[model samples]
Target: MRIRRWSTVSVAAVMTVALAVVLWSSGAPQGGRVVGLGSVVPWGSADPRSPMAPPPVRGQAGPVVGGLSASSVGVLVVDGGRHQCSASVVASQSRRLLATAAHCVWLDGAWRVDGATFIPGYAAGEEPYGRWQVDTAYVPPAWTEANSPIEDVAADVDMAFVSVLPRDGVLPEQVLGAQGISFSTPPQVEVAALGYPALGSYDGQSLRGCVGTGAVEAFTRPESPKPSEIRSLDCDMTQGASGGPWLAGPDADSGRGQVVGVVSGGDDTHLVSPRFGPAAKQIYDAADTAALAATAPAPSPSTDPMSAQIAPRGGS
Candidate 1:
């Protein structure tokens, strides 16, 4: 199914519309230099003996209550009103970084450069912290160059970091608070995956979460040089949940933990993510540098919501 792109529609209309686009395109690409697979390295310390645990036997879906996850995680409205994805605020040097799935930013052999906006603590049709516009998106070169229709190749480098334009001279991290990110950790670590899945028994109106142990899995295709290893969780989140943060720790309430991965994709019973490692770190570093060097645009006259259709929340 072709994913709908947001058009010149009003914000109120876009929120209530049923925008269920296909998860991703899996057709042959025109042409591009497919890069050979590189050796995967851990993003931080590792322990091969990390005990393997069972999948998240319990899960919850609805509006986030109150806590770090509730405040830091948000929904992404891309290309004006065409596409929607999940994203979260990750701690960065520039204090303006967001983590999400690469497909959310790049798809169909090109970047979806129509105006992208993020709404943290989005519930139903409410925007709590306001809407922050995306400024720059950093995706792995492997994803951009690969021409194979195999989802594995794209999944290997599925992660991305985006820089958000500040609202009212305030950075996103400052507004939403940031979650710590970690890499190179052992497999089978317990984590909580959060997102706004807009498919299946879901309506993309609230945030959902799944807590489970993550296992390493490998996928190989004939056109690719080698198989790519990724992390997997037995969560039923679909579509709009792409790019949700996978937090590692024993407590899901406090929301104080390291982000080990992001929602990449899944079948009917499991969700997948690129194991956070060297490739992901590179993208994060590049986004940080770009955000630090970015110049803020001049502030424009504020739009009054009292006269507009959508109610004005926060500063959006």
Candidate 2:
């Protein structure tokens, strides 16, 4: 998930409420164009995109308790390099698409197009299986431009999808497998949030959460926020919890969860999302095309490792 790396700002002088609004409304430029704040930037943005800024808070709030299902989430690393972000499997027809915050995948100006990897079901700082290399990532076009965080550019289109492959070119089904996706739902729906919070380890000292919630339609954004993708959640998430998944409904077929929004940023104690707006629909369409191609040829049990998969994380 995304965390604003603090410089030397002091606790007493830290402007919690004010900065949270500013950070939430801030934006940047990418791909030689201006983008809105809260939008995901490619790895190429220089100084345009900023981190998911949050207030100096203790833990996340709202319908939260622990974190998410480890089996469905993974650690997103830049180019198989150091771990920097988090992602969750959303669509798995062929392309192996993942859902996460736009900022988590994009940085500076370029979209970390290379050496990116996904370690599925990683636990306790352990990579039981090898890391899976990413093939490509998709970000909303509007987010590529620069904008204002206070305007709420991110609360809307904060989510993105990526295609991945094993370092050895093995199919995703050969390893941890992929998840399913759904759209066509109304707002203020119930969902379960999942992700990896680097700040909180499995250790007792670290406050990690794998929680669930049935809360619906927490709050809506202003008419014209910056990036226009952000929405508000009462959930209690913390730093290192950005880019998590806000699953909409239960996975009756795959037994996994349907993604409605991506955790992008929040205030001192709550989580924020990009309302699962039109941008999300656009990305999902593209991702569905990619996934279909990846699993071409009618997907047979012998040929398609995911054919028998009723739903997410390889169950049912």
Candidate 3:
């Protein structure tokens, strides 16, 4: 996704107009005061509406073949189902939290609050864990107020959390199993970036991933924009993959890992994510806090941890 392109929001598809246009479609918050440092590499943004839509990532990636990890990652249905982005279930006490890019849920100066659903373990038109509706989305105050020409997006506030309504009395975490997430990101970590690529020979049905060391990319514009630092890696996961997770200490088969960042945007060769920090922790806390406030009964003693509900794709 390019910063200059005014198409949709998948790393850089900026569609600020109608729903048809707010389409590189995607979803942010948490607490720790953010700190940033990175190499200044200028990569102009792209026009996603162009027939030559940019590749989702800058490097090679393949299907997340046969892993319970893919089960936690899902297609985020938004724009009244006219558009989609990738999201994931993350560990939360309430078992109802999802981690995704803020742009996926709130964009074009407003929240994409209508008809948001998360389909976990979705592949080839199959919903392995069924579908869950998103009841609430939380964006940091900085993100909602981040519209400025100098800074295309506020790096400090690009991530968001969504709280989904239960399905058949079961929360998403109870079924899909949540990935572990941390607001205190390390200086550098090897990670596997995962998502469902919608364009560029991708059907947007299955999970795909690219692995690399994530490094911070800082922006220092001539106009002296806000101090911004975002984690980036070489990935070709492109438009539909926004809001996907960057997992460190990832299991090759189970996909269990620590989430360090969320996909935000990327140039053709690299994907970007706002560094998770104290601000992010606060937003995450807000969502988690709300889940605790709900009236749902305590989970049964038999409740387990991080388990996918249904068989994986191509399974019997």
**lDDT leader:** 1
lDDT of 1 at 316: 29
The order of the candidates by TM-score, greatest first, is 1, 3, 2
Better of 2 and 3 by lDDT: 3
What order do candidates take by lDDT, descending?
1, 3, 2
- Deviating ranges (above 4 Å) for candidate 3: 1-58, 148-151, 220-226, 250-254, 295-316
Q: Candidate 2, residues 1-316: lDDT per residue as tens digits? A: 2233211112211111111101111132211111212322222211121222221232342112122334456667652253345577665556466777666555434455456667665544456666776655666655555332322333445567776654465666545544555555564565555554432111111112333343323332334343222334454444345566666655411225676676665544445566665556666666555555553432223322211111111110
| Count of residue pairs whose backbone atoms collide, per candidate | 7, 63, 37
TM-score of 2: 0.60
Candidate 1, residues 1-316: lDDT per residue as tens digits?
3212211111111101111122221222212211221111112211122122222245433334457876788887764446678889999989988988877777656565457788888776667788888886777777666631323335657777877888889888887998989878896788888887765556566677777777776654345666666777766666678788888876653455778888876654667688898778877876676577657342112422121111011122
Go through the candidates in order and give each one's C-alpha lDDT: 0.63, 0.45, 0.62
Candidate 1 weakest ten by summed lDDT: 9-18
Q: Global lDDT for candidate 2?
A: 0.45
- Candidate 1 stretches with Cα past 4 Å from truth are 1-63, 147-153, 296-316
Error of 3 at 79 (Å): 1.6
